[model samples]
Target: MTEFNEKQIDILQVAERLFAEKGFDGTSIRDISKEAKINIAMISYYFGSKEKLLEALIFSRTADLKIQLENLRNEAIPPMEKIDRLIEFYVHRINKNKCIYQILHFEFSSQKRSVDFKAFTEVKKSNLLSLEKIITEGQDLGIFKKNIVIALIPPTILGTYFHFNMNRPYYEEIFDLKTEQDYDNYIKTDLTKHIQQTIKALLVYEN
Candidate 1:
């Protein structure tokens, strides 16, 4: 995440919430300025434009994840442990900031293309390549199955989380969740474990 001053952070936070609630197209710069209690010129001065602001928001949210993954590649830990940590990191982050998933889902599902989509795709590709390296290391050590398709792992982990997040409201309704904390607890515990186990199974299972 690019470091921002308090005011920039404030603007980004409000923008994220509005984007989650109203979506990118539905939201206006005026909406963000009003919600953030900042002048219109300030936002433009800080972020260039709404498109760049969205880009900054995505970078802010994902930069840490990218850093974490990069650090994992250098750690002396075993491959399985690295995988476990990766899963934990993603789950915990998503649990803390549900808006990241909301923005991703909205961007992917929208008919109109976002200028920042290409940047987002490049970020994903880099992360996936990093993951593939870890998986390949495991295969070399005969820990992960040789037949495992490295490309599929990222999508499997990400897709599962995204699917659950997009359908969270339905799940909450079905399960009769009365509070946000209740739902967060369920994701932090149950969903995290499920994804970890599923990924491990895919990596180590015999055909």
Candidate 2:
């Protein structure tokens, strides 16, 4: 597990909230300072610059996710169980820290071509690695169908999170889900059920 100092987390918390609210370029150092209720010098002292603070958020989130995913990746679990656990982990993680999905989807949508993209790349690749391992193992053991959309599952699953978490305005207006409680019911009752059903459809079935 990666241990972040209190100061680092404080800086990241401010950055995540600001980035979610105002976006990357739209947010400024002074804004973070004021929101964080810390001196501007502390922001600079910890992260160096506003740009670097944003990058820190990206890196920190990905790194933390990578660690959690690894712990859940065990060969003993059935592929379907593995798959379900992964989905549960993602949903739980995002719900616990809205900023995880919020900041990630926020920056990714910007299309600014960040230098820290590789940090995200590693986390994604690690996740894909875990998925592929379980999938191939299932295939070898005759637990999963031979023809599976294994490669594309990564993007599709993660994309679902992005679609729902990032597109708040659309859901609020279209589905009348503006409050946290409404959104909670949506995720637990509908959104999570939807993702698992889709995953079942994607995996090849050979009976």
Candidate 3:
């Protein structure tokens, strides 16, 4: 992805937040301009259209994950460790970019697809394929069991996180979370461990 200028980045951030809060169809250039403190003409000048802007946002947000996956694939570490790190990376990324991830989750789940759905799915497919390659390598090395449903693996990880994220208020009470730092710590440590264990159980051979 090309480097985004400061204004472009600002617009993207505002757009992501609005799209997450108000659905892509609900948000307009005027809303973005109002929130971003910029003129609508500038958004047009930079991105041409709302669909193109969304496409850029999705690609830019996912570009690093793609590179990270590629790097992880070539690392000398054990495949299970790679999977663990991938899960950790995902948890951190989603937590950090909560709004963008929510927007992505909505885009994936919505029945009325957006114009940028193609770009979104492409990014999604690329990331899934990367994870699949790592899992396949593990199977080849006898580290993971064969006949695992590769398609289910991503949703298992993603859905779990989404459920926790979307129900944060309920979870806060259940977990007695009082502070922002407390919630972050809980998710990173306890929740992350649970996900790692679940995926390990699914992938590892049962004796």
| Pairs with backbone N, CA or C atoms under 3 Å apart (clashes), candidate 3 | none
- Point to the candidate with the largest lDDT: 3
In candidate 1, which residue ranges exceed 4 Å CA deviation? 169-178
Can you write out model 1's per-residue Cα lDDT over 1-207, one digit (the tens) per residue? 358889988998999999988988899999999999889999999999888899888877877788889999889999999998989887887767788677876677877765656666677788888888899899999999988887887778778887887798898998777798988887878888899999999999998
State every prediction's TM-score relative to the real structure: 0.88, 0.81, 0.89
Top TM-score hit: 3
Model 3 Cα shift for residue 126 (angstroms): 2.1
| Candidate 1 similarity to native, TM-score | 0.88
Candidate 2's displacement at residue 132, Å, is: 1.1
- Summarize candidate 3's per-residue lDDT along 1-207 as a digit string, tens digits: 457989899999999988987889999999999999989999999999998898888877877877788888889999999999999988887788787777776666877755555665776788888889999999999999987988788788878888998899999999999999999999999999999999999998575
What's model 3's TM-score? 0.89
Each prediction's whole-model lDDT (CA): 0.85, 0.75, 0.86
Question: Could you give me the TM-score of model 2 versus the true structure?
Answer: 0.81
User: RMSD in angstroms, candidate 1?
Assistant: 2.2
Q: How accurate is candidate 1 locally (lDDT)?
A: 0.85
lDDT of 2 at 119: 55
